[model samples]
Target: MSSRKAEPREYHGAAGGFGSLQGIARIELKERAGPGAAETLYRQNKPEGHMCTSCAWAKPPNPHLAEFCENGAKATLWDLTSERCTPEWISRHTVTELRERSGYELEMRGRLTEPMRYDAGTDRYVRASWDEAFAAIGAELHRLDPKSVTFYASGKAALEPSYLYAVFARAYGHNNLPDSSNMCHETTSVGLKKVVGSPVGTCTLQDLDHCDAIFYLGQNPGTNSPRLLRPLMQAAKRGCKIITFNPLREKGLLEFIDPQDPVAMLTQKPTKMSHMYMQVKPGGDIAALMGVIKRVLEIDDEAKEKGLARTLDDAFLAEHTHGFDALRHTVENTGWDAIEANSGIARADLERAGDVYAGAKNVIGIYGMGLTQHVHGSQAIGMLVNLLLLNGNIGRQGAGCTPIRGHSNVQGQRTVGITEKTKLAPVEKYRELLDLETPEEDGHTTVEFLEALLDGSNKGFIGLGGNLAQAVPDHERVHRAWGEMELTVHIATKLNKTHLMPGKSSWILPCLVRAEEDMQASGRQTVTMEDSFSHIYGSIGKRKPASEQLKSETAIVAGLAKATLAHRETRNPKLAWDEWTGDYARIRDLIAHTFPDEFHDMNGRMNQPGGFYRGNGAHDRIWKTDSGKAEFTDPTVLNACGIGEADGRFHLVTVRSNDQFNTTVYGHSDRLRGLEGTRMMVMINPDDMERHGLADGDLVTLIGDAEDDMERTVRGLKVTPYRLPDGCLAGYFPELNPLVPLWYHDKLSKTPASKGIPVRIVKE
Candidate 1:
């Protein structure tokens, strides 16, 4: 018989709709015995006697009764599932077999039970002892030039482990450290650092409560950062004006009927959100922001002329900022006609938004990847910062810039010095403290690392976490790079595509998950994580370790360092790898000494119930620049390459569904968007569809204009007719990553052009 082609399910409007019904059926089917196989495919990663680690780590009696969000619950459920994938199972299966499975299927296959190494000769992975794996990895490191090795860390690991990895890499004489941050929030760091002298956001989650007006630009906090919704809902209830600016009208931004709210649940009424909404086209945020700024300036000028009051905070600007004249000239030169045409927003709407911002005593601006994924993303952020500076809205009680981070500890990972360009002063200080030689040269970023891999310059890779191939754009290029590596080591809790990359010598080292107990040399240890709000909190495992064989990421790093760094004893007498495993406090002490301003007296701070705030420019409106003020940068041309016109093509913007997080696909469904059990769909406006002779549920192929040969055929895709702009089209990422060339990244940040890819669509 021929292989069965899966038929697409049609949408049905119901509380438990067609998609939900199908999901229920799939769940039931998986629970039933099939031949000799296990009844259920889904299993948690935690061992027996699992508890809430986050609750224990929380201050005092804990901030709330429940310390987890819906996504966090899902994350924990997967972490503590009763599933196992032994090394013997992998030994029986070839790499080709594993590659054929879906990403979800591979992940649900189970936890890594033992350390395993890829055997190139047999084309299978074989069991390798932890000691043997570490020794092999160390040997490879010793063989290669320090600069030839790249250390890519993920946000999964605890604070101690990440810090240890950073020290190990620097001691090994290479700063080639490209982390998960390189792909997500690198633009925020780059933009903020240049303007305000800090890479982190200035506001705390508590600030959301006090703001009179909150401007959400280019972000979907409901799906991306659900924890933020509670506060937003509370603010909205208290009559705070919430304004949203994005290309898509996200369901979360519309209104949320909080399941936790008993009154609302009983009444069956949802709180309304977004007093005003504006949908700007892709790459149009800069012009929109500039329009608002220009409106604010005009308002201030009018007030000054009428002798009503000085709307411009001239005193604050003069003392706390620079480059105002150049900024003024640029804004003055930009015509309203150009701004309206480019932004797809009328002058009146932008004027109203500016009025809302100007009228509020305390306002906050929150943004996400939609504002940072373009070629001019950094510039857009700078413009936002400049606007905030003009109003003197930062460093106050309820006002600041907030960049929503993706990963749990993404901000913390970068905070502890994970970067290609390691600041020389800090490295020297660390060297002096540890009595070790510091590497002089800077490291390679994700883009440069890929180039190095392609050219056979970088031979080995140690990915602390994340599926590099799936997460990075232009995955084919990443796949080829993985094939060229001599050694590929993945320290993770579960199996991922990056582990199956098959290097000359590859090892998958099973490590303790975040929700599992991390018993180092220290008894009952805890890890620190910095949230997007800049609040530092402690996290301990709620459950027992998955297996005794599994080690903490800290121990693994120490073992690898011991094996790789030959002259460790000469560095310092206190540098005892064995002793270091016993106590994470010592690591904290080292961190405190290194980042005195941030982590001073770690024990004292951790003992407190609620974690203390890290230092941001919020205490005083002091900018950390060469001129000791916020610098306003104004480029001559907004877009080096002008607005992408739709001659015979549509501008494609890659997006994530409500269910997905980064590259980790929990399920192939988006509950809010009405997409069920399928990711192969594109959202386009009715006008665009009418123009192309397409209807709902029509299969189409997208052809890239960058090159003639680049194209992707997506069949049986439901073309959801929505109120999207005529020239714009939206689709999910990774699958659409093929449409974006690696060479099409932003010139300044080297971030992939994921948001805006010029492509023509046709019926298949």
Candidate 2:
């Protein structure tokens, strides 16, 4: 309990003004990119340079000189650092010693200079040749059954590598391909697909320009996707109402100063971002959404009774949707008391939200991990889709659901067939392009794959990128399981905690990042990525590779595939691995050939300015579902709040600090939350702290409320009072991931319920 303490202060300044510039300057100085900072920042998110690896906010058709945000600069500078994690430097530290370092410290050690192999004899990583590493990995992979080997990818990879990875996995004869999507936006895919017949968001960047109202649910844009703040500010300036529903009044949603706007930056007068901020409690999004829908319906009925203009789009409902009557009945039959109790919002406020929603001609529903990382995440997403469906907001100029993605190419990975589901994989395309028949059996998701690792069903792991050991829930359990694997290979630009959890035969293959030049036999190659808006674009790194020994992800995957399949008997003989690695265009050609509809002219279109759209069927009102129309989920079957009956336990939501992105930590400070020098602090309501006999900086231990009888606990967390709803607590992830049992996830999507985790906070 004595190990935790934090410097907490109140931040009255708006998001993204001088604060962002200061943060950017700090990172640039720390990374020694000060001299080249202007050039690097200006080139980010531009057609001529590499894409920003931070977040997947769509690039505007006409981007500003400083198109990137503070986090984007952090990612770019972090990759552009002069430090190197050479084999000699790594040999000085033991695995146990390296494991004790923080994620930020480990990553800051610098980029991996070459391949490394774990030596159990010395308990340290030793230098290994690329060919030797690949051969050893391939031998182990060949020895194990395809089902026992899982191929995991991080969204940080570009499209060329992602496509090659999926093709190699399918060609290897199993579907155990789980990527970053499974952890972050899988629920968005699962929930939206059921209703609109498309697994991606329907809205584009252009939609923000014309929307009358933008409803933000469980989203903090300032930290998650700062580039989005510009559009939101523009919309607000044009009189568009921005309504936000979240547990905390995130500063980003309250106000913002556009760093790109010269006048706003000079004056320091913040632009009001949100017209209405609904501070809903954890696990209350579904109930709150239902409450709003009920009021909208009630108002529509009143208008009908008065023979006035109908509030609901009756024509769209009749011709374009199904199960409306059932949905209406369920909403009407539900009592106001249940809605008010579950949502923690009064009837009057719900009606007011409904009034704004009903008055808007076009409304866009924007959400993030808050809506997807819960016990009932899919249902929450479905409810949002249904709300937009009510007013015929979808398939319009400025409306539809948009799930802001955290990774730059997470969607692109999925689009190129990185999925565990047999139905979701591009099976026919693989058969056509690679002359291989993919396995039809459904494979493991991120959760299921980890379970496989724990149960001994899976013995091999091949990570294209990411720090899975820390990214998933039940961090300790997952890390222990990883150490028992037969072979574990990580393809990354730098060292991470995952590299320290060495298996029986472990290796690290350093690859070129998106911000570095990736030279191949075809010459300096450009890679592609798909944003949250389904815009596929190219990225050509301007800087030289961190090390000449490093290989591009495409080359690494191709090398491994060639070596592994050499040992196994396969029907496919024309894989052209050498040719594909030599020319990235061949990979893109295969991708275009496989998903013709989405990537038809990929090679030509990917490099074009602003890229080309991977058109969404739902956006065109062309439902591809069995019913051939948008389907409404039966509301009776959905839970209002899946966290369970109210008790003395506090609902803990694990969140990312402003200094971190996903599992990657950049620094110890969170400027937005006004917490510095530590990530071990918890934010709780003032009333809850008083009830628990706790004061600011008091240490506490949170106990999991899982029924599995697992003893999950995290101690030495400093409590800081905040404006969160009573009985709700917020803390950083990975640190608190231990309290989230591996089983605590959405049953349908299998995404970890990082939000709304029921736990007992006991002061130490």
Note the Cα lDDT for every prediction shown.
0.72, 0.86
TM-score against truth, every candidate? 0.91, 0.98
- Candidate 2 structure quality by residue, lDDT tens digits, 1-764: 22232233457889999998898778777777535657867888888788999999888767787889988988888888888889999999999899999888999888899999999998999999998998999888988899999999988888888888988898887899999888878988887888889899999889999999988999888788988888899999999998888988787888899887889898999999999888887878888889999999999999999999888998999899998888888898988898887777888888888999999999999999888988888888888888999989999899998999998999989988889988888877677766788888988999999899879898989999999888888877888888999999999988999999999999999999887787788798989999989999888986877788999999999999999989866445678889998989988888888888889988888867777898999999998777999988765433333567467777888888788888888888788877788888889876676666777888888888876767888899998878888778899987898888888887678888888888898888
lDDT of 2: 0.86
Show where candidate 1 strays beyond 4 Å: 1-62, 567-574, 635-643, 707-718
Q: What is the lDDT of residue 121 in candidate 2?
A: 93
Which candidate leads the pack in lDDT? 2
The candidate that wins on TM-score is: 2
Q: Write the per-residue lDDT of candidate 1 for residues 502-576, one digit (tens) a residue.
A: 789889998887666677645877777666766666666646666778988888888988888753345555456
Q: Which 10 consecutive residues of model 2 have the lowest summed lDDT? A: 1-10
User: For candidate 1, which ten residues in a row score worst on lDDT?
Assistant: 37-46
Report per-prediction Cα RMSD to one decimal: 5.4, 2.3
